[model samples]
Target: MSSSSAEVLLVRTGAAATLDRTSVGGRGTVASALVKTPRLGAVSVGELGFQGDVQADLEVHGGPAKAVLVYSDEHYDDWVAELGRDLRGTGLGENLRIRGLTERDVCPGDRIAVGSALFRVSAPRRPCYKLALAHGIRDLSARVQRSGRTGFYLAVDRPGEVRAGDRIAIIEHAPHRISAFEVNRVINLDKRDVDGARRVLTAAADLPPRWVAKLRRRVDGAVESDASDTARLYGTD
Candidate 1:
């Protein structure tokens, strides 16, 4: 597939596993292994998530709104340069390592098809403490958010099979043009931009409820800073 034509560069799935307590902010012995195993061929995609994939914490991760986490192959080089290491095969806790589409190109509510499975872009993936735990980097989550290189989540619209080489085509573009990159920036970095927050919360009808709640808090002056609730929910702290 052409670079402009979105494609699944890799298909990955994780087993139910635990985290070690030694990692910073580790949720000792939890039942999730966000790190995924790259599948060699086709794999089934479901509404909850990919086959064999399990999320440790449901309060923050793994739901209909975030059934499939997607990361761009485009960001791998940047991550290597920044972290001074290779991150391939890490899955980045994402079900699909994709090419062609980045946060800037996709928006909430956009519909896409990968092989036979269909998905709707639900929201941007909020980097939490789990990210730091997964990579053994103390400040990776903050760095990812600041760089606006965070990936996105996809809500499964139609269950089917997806392979590594499957073409990911945009079947429907969202009417609202608020990209996932903008959403991440507004929520994680620019909490003071009341106008921007209002635009995202009001214009993006399909924005995830948790994000909507957070943005509403920001718009209403309920939150005084950029401290997010994700750490509390996932026990990243």
Candidate 2:
């Protein structure tokens, strides 16, 4: 393992709310909890998420495998340079804004201890329309995916409380599995990487079933059409 240490820079949470068409350009009203704001001091964490945190779409979000969203502050500078704005704070809707850890550092199944709670690296986040709507950029979701700065999700292993400045120590690292960055690279960015997909599937037994199934499909030669991929990647509007 590298000498880099993971540390929490911020903790954020928010409830789901309805958005009108005007707010989403012309895509009609929708419900989303993507507008996360920093939470002062320690915050309670559970199997689902932080105490007040809510996800509008349980079908795609807010489950055990995706209990918490984590973003690396290491990417914020690049985001600001790309978006031409101050992209700090909870603009990315991550429950934990962390430093010294990125997709390349953690692999699926790695156990992490943060504050009083423990978590496992589950999967790399797949950006959707909510991100685009939040930033008012039509293709920002796709851009994020292609850029490989898509952050990641975590499953609560031992629920407790977390606070800013908490050290994120990896207690158990899954050396056999590919890092989250490699997953995103082969599956999202380099779509033609069949051998890479196979390698991921071979070692990613700890990933969610849906994610495993998705990779299995790709490796088995059942790739989705570009139109379908676009819809899944960006969502409506």
Candidate 3:
């Protein structure tokens, strides 16, 4: 999709973000909403069967919308963050549509302008099991690795109100040469059993070398056994 065609719009929140999970797949609108968090930025999904209602808000933070982790890639259906693309315009159940934009085009720490609303890419989206079955998409986990279009985690850069049909523009917020996806890809290439969990470990394990040390211990122990390090990292023991 072309950058000029890039757009971000706001739809009502059908669900809320979990305090524990930045994003979640559920049956209906979230019963609870954060009292303080803004709901406009959250990415809400209707029942997780794929190609269904999906929305991204343009304003506010702290509520469920701010919590949604999102991503896009041009190589695939782009359902990674967009619901309409997967449905093939069968009519996007999505509350909002991002046109001509997917995870591949966004850069980490980049600020996106959707009218008066602004959002920054916080991190990369992790593939969950439900996304696989809901969309009936095969090799999704692997696709993330090969495509490098892994969707992004968003943080509210500027809080404001947004609505559908709003044009969105991406603004660079960081001078860093590496993107979160690039770092993840490098780590995935070097390590085995590298999934979302492992990616987090590799990305953050550096904060506390002791944590990395602890992982080293667990990884070594798993290697001695029949299990792979990735399995142990995921607590598959």
Candidate 4:
């Protein structure tokens, strides 16, 4: 299949900074790089991520497999409509916002070339409360998952420079044909989807190992894992 004519709308990077907030639902100080600034020109891409980009929580956020986070600019309209507010400069903490492709259009393990960098689609982002905190929406993280607008992560295969307006083209497609949407659906929305879980496992070699283990256990009929600490992770009362 031909690659979609995806164009990067923005390239953003940020360092970890302190955000102090007090609200009816919550109050605290947190270190986050969720607030990103647009990079005006080409930026270096490395095995970890774009130059100057940093994740506050390395435990859950950044790693070799999640070097870059890509969001679909296409979802912004839906979000604006749902939130009933102006989000003109809000990035929702994404590294690259691009058009012409969404979760359904990309599959795990697919190799994509954007600018001079080569990347492999990794997995759907499992959003948490920092996203909600960033947007001041208590349920925004949950909304992102349930809406199937969960942007994806990219593992840099060949480190190079990237910048705004770079063309995104898939150089190789995953053999399994399972889109990132289906993977997120199986894991977050359709936990009972045994068949879907099996299909996801077919692409295990190309997916994040943590997700692979989760699916493997599901396929083996193992007991469901411990529930996520939603209150802690989502900052909801």
* Best candidate, TM-score: 4
Top lDDT: which candidate number?
4
Cα lDDT of model 4 overall?
0.84
**lDDT tens digits by residue: candidate 2, 56-139:** 988889899899999988788898899886667437779999998899998889999999999999889988767776767767
TM-score, prediction 1: 0.89
Off by over 4 Å in 3: 9-12, 16-66, 71-97, 137-139, 187-237
Candidate 1 structure quality by residue, lDDT tens digits, 63-118: 88889999999898888898888777564788899989899998899899888999
Write out the backbone clash pairs for model 2: none
lDDT of 4 at 195: 90
Better of 2 and 4 by TM-score: 4
Per-candidate clashes come to: 0, 0, 17, 0
TM-score ranking from best candidate downward? 4, 2, 1, 3
* Residue 209 lDDT, candidate 3, scale 0-100: 48
Clashing pairs in 1: none
The superposed Cα distance between candidate 1 and the true structure at residue 76, in angstroms, equals 0.9
Residue 41 in model 4: lDDT: 91
So what's the TM-score on candidate 2?
Answer: 0.92
Give per-residue lDDT, candidate 3, residue 83: 32
User: Per-prediction TM-score, please?
Assistant: 0.89, 0.92, 0.50, 0.93
Which is the better candidate, 1 or 4, if ranked by TM-score?
4
Off by over 4 Å in 4: 1-4, 21-24, 223-226, 229-233
Weakest ten-residue segment in model 4 by summed lDDT: 223-232
lDDT of 2 at 104: 90
